[model samples]
Target: MQFKNIISGAAVLLASAPAVMALGSATVVNNCGYPIYFASVGQSQHANMQPLQGSYSEGYSQQGVGISIKLAPNNTVGGPVSQFEFTWANGKIAYDLSNIDGYPFSAGGMQVVPSTQGDSSNPTCVPVDCPAGQSVCTAAYNAPDDVRTMVCDENTSLTLTMCPGGSAKRSVEVREHIRYRVHARHFTVEQ
Candidate 1:
């Protein structure tokens, strides 16, 4: 009886392993009066992304970012899909869902409307996790408000949905009615 129990437990764990590793979501909501386009990027190193060149190579954006696996290779979102997926490991991931390049600065627009769930402290399993308005730099190279970080002890799914034009924070850089708040949720990925 003891041997049978151990065998059954191990089998269950093995069967559910793939489903766990292949987990994560970034649901971008377009609250800006106009449409929005952006990418959910996961980088092994967080310090190098700057100037906003959306590429799936160069060690960072390659982790996978798209509406679906079918549209992810290009890693751009503007069509029918509104969801994204990526893999996380090594306890933490450096990531961001940004629309800086696509944002109509000339039109005085804002993107990434998040809820009050946006957090600064290095938290575990919290959805829509972001760093404090980065003081690391003030130039264009500085981390955008959309920049985020995730820390969890086990394989987890951290998600954030931006509700722009809602009750989100307003940046001083651009003086427009456009605001964003990110709501987050952390939960275990099950088989």
Candidate 2:
């Protein structure tokens, strides 16, 4: 009876050995919320990727201003990886404008209008305050208003007001709007 028990235990150990030694697959996936757009990737070090045995190289993508890498099976290798770096984008507007009277006040928001019919060569003028009696002025700025959620490509009209934060009264052609640029960035990690 003792000999039989010893033989059965050895057989069970032998049967599970192969299962324990079986290696896991390597896969990469984007677990991040942001996506990278227009990206370049390389090993963090000059030595290139020091992947552990049984591990494999996956791939990457540029979503908005974020970069995502995907892996399969997610196992095997010497150990976990370090960190990664990248660059990307944020949805922003850009343009030029000319104003005439009271500072342009559109409690609504600024509109980004594209044109080819109008004089494209006209030099973009600087924003200036209206002289006495002049209720209008002209300037340009990428609409920072939360138009993405409120309005979709709304026309950038104007209200001749005493100040930017003032109340709107009469409409005017000369708009003292703001023109500027925006920069966006993002990062990712792998283990």
Clashes of each: 12, 27
lDDT (Cα, tens digit) per residue for candidate 1, span 94-188: 33333332222212222222122334544433443223333221111123463443344322333332332243332224445644544476534
Q: What is the C-alpha lDDT of each candidate?
A: 0.33, 0.26
Q: Candidate 1: lDDT over CA atoms? A: 0.33
Residue 43 of model 2 has an lDDT of 36
TM-score of each: 0.31, 0.15
lDDT, model 1, position 55: 20
Global Cα RMSD, each model: 18.0, 27.9
Mark the regions of model 1 whose C-alpha exceeds 4 Å error after superposition.
1-22, 39-87, 97-148, 153-191
Best by lDDT: 1
Top TM-score: which candidate number? Answer: 1
